[model samples]
Target: MKDLIILWLSGGNDAWWSVLVAMGNPWQVLDLGAVLALIVVGMQIAVATCLPDRLWADDGTNAFFSQLSYLHIFLLMALTALAEEIFFRAAIQSLLVEWLHSVAAGIAVPAAIFAVAQRARPASCASASRAAPATASSWG
Candidate 1:
């Protein structure tokens, strides 16, 4: 997906690309990804039924989705979760753990960062990931 790369990388080969492209145990990745997808999808449905989109989302976000078919939206949401997991858990939070030499500080810093970042607007449904619950807070 061309759009996935652009959205994830924003047109540059920063260290983030290395983070996104790294490989892991096949079964492990599949299992975790599936769990994350399920969580996000469930959260998406809840948000749609419970909250007005205008409360959490902006017109630009609505316009972006308006251009896509249902299948595209589904795929976008799935990819968004995966990409976010890689960025927050696999990279930022892990790095924080090592640098801060404290697991609490590690997860805490990134969790706060994630909450702030998603404050930009209602992000694609929910950023659900069991391994990284902090990012999932946006799972409104």
Candidate 2:
């Protein structure tokens, strides 16, 4: 478990280091896709929180659709999807296979580690709720 966590963190650090060296600096590049992704994510959250009841209304659709015309959104989404897949599915999985030196071991180790990492938030949320006793007023 410790080894897997270490590997994951180190891999991320290494990736960032390499990216910095190769790209000279990420901020300098006009990453339209990232900007678009951020705008989309922010808008989604804003709509969900501020206008939850009307999110699916015609006006909401119009507002959301307008963002789609921005070229940066498409670029950001494509780059993000590609980068995530390569990092997690290819690079991390391949490294795990190399370290474990067995197909089953490699797959199992990384998969288990990945599952645990991914589920940490939900698991913690569940545990926290369970730990808190239900109150009559809250339930009502």
Q: Best-fitting candidate, measured by TM-score?
A: 1
Candidate 1 residue 55 Cα shift, in angstroms, is: 7.9
Off by over 4 Å in 1: 1-60, 121-140
TM values, all candidates: 0.47, 0.33
Q: Give the clash count for each candidate.
A: 0, 1
Candidate 1, overall lDDT? 0.71
Lowest-sum lDDT 10-residue window in model 1 = 127-136
TM-score of 1: 0.47
Q: How high is the lDDT of residue 22 in model 2? A: 61
Error of 2 at 13 (Å): 38
Instruction: Report how far off residue 34 is in candidate 1 (Å).
Output: 8.9
Q: For each candidate, what is the lDDT?
A: 0.71, 0.63
- After superposition of all CA atoms, the RMSD between model 1 and the true structure is 15.5
